[model samples]
Target: MSDALLDIRGLTAGYGDVPVLTDIALTVGAGEIVALVGSNGAGKTTLLRAVSRIIKASGSLRFLGEDVLPLTPEALFARGLVQVPEGRQLFGRMTVAENLMMGAYRRRDRAGIDASLAQTFDLFPVLAERRAQTAGSLSGGEQQMCAIGRALMAAPKLLMIDEMSLGLAPIVVDRLLDVLVAIRGQGVPILMVEQDVFAALAVADRGYVLEHGRIVKAATAETLKSDPALQKAYLGSDS
Candidate 1:
């Protein structure tokens, strides 16, 4: 079996005629956590959407060695390429449990789905505690957890999370990233897009720096942490 879970080559995508991603190429190996970091308007979200096939794109997108560019979002989900999108797009009117159950809507294995729900609760006890509460009633951090748990219900092989640390307290973000690390330990590769560069790099095994829709640097987390250019551009200072 190949170690590369997801691969992209010469990816070019955008909205309408305006291109956002230009000649982008990257890879996520099985069980690896790869972070995509960049400043605002750097096309980080567009890249994830392109990989998820949510928008029209031109590229070689492969998952598990099979071409994925031809697949739709639903098809991609069926193949375990699940994305926890930015803004935690949960059903506001639905109960937390209901929203979570929706994640397994495509699944037919009742017993297996139940098992996965239990696992999700175990991973996030807060959700279990708030199962009866409407999703919109939860705190910002709690909503984020529900979003991730919902994606997990799909039993994805490659989990793509966008902006995991957005709009949360530092402590909350830390807790969420810890759970993500735990999830990675279960052998699921993660392609994470985060503006919280320090936190993202802390957990990432390798990372790519995207600027103006291009990958300007690819390096291990340790090397990226020390790059002066990255430090000045992303980390706020060259020192």
Candidate 2:
């Protein structure tokens, strides 16, 4: 746990008076993909928001050996704790290239930012082709790709993506999964919040199942895939 790229302990977060997450403990190691899967309204988004400091949270949280509990969202982002938020929240009126450039807004290294942009375009060539087009003009899958490309521009060491497959076609999701594997190969760890339990676990090194904001199960991806209870509830498997 000491070597974890992101670590959380006893984390509780919510909106105003309503509690959504309770005593959550999780870890994402360097160069690993950790999946957080749960039903809708089960506090999956809340957990991500807490880690990104977009919401109030109390408990020990650390990133790369530094405590992040007291850090602001921009501060966390500067430390490579970047979140590709749900809904592919792109600037609708902006060109795809402009949206991607927004990801490096905090960086001072112009050359490194450009290199990251090139890498992003290499990984998502469709984005490069549509660079001058307005972001909102793209299809659902294309929008998702642009959103991911924008995140990659931040040069994140720990990329936390929320709902990578949401509203995407099966083929597009497959392609994104392949891209995620490639990203992990490049040594950037990911902490993903996904609704498609099977797909999330398929690409994950480890997975955690949340029910009512509490972690009900935590196991290796292979073990989780074969779990009878999880299969019945999430994967629609009879056995």
Q: What is the lDDT for 37 in model 2?
A: 92
lDDT of 1 by residue, 1-239 (tens): 34588988899999989999999989999778999999999999999999989888997888999998999988999999999857999999999999999989999999989998998999899999999999999999999999999999988899999999998999999999898899999878899999999899889999999999999889998998888888887767848
lDDT, residue 101, model 1? 94
TM-score versus the correct structure, for each prediction: 0.96, 0.97
In order, the Cα lDDT scores of the candidates are 0.91, 0.92
- Predicted structure 2: lDDT: 0.92
Off by over 4 Å in 2: none
lDDT of 2 by residue, 144-210 (tens): 9899888998899999999999988889999999999999998999999999999998899999999
What TM-score does prediction 1 earn? 0.96
Error of 1 at 146 (Å): 0.3
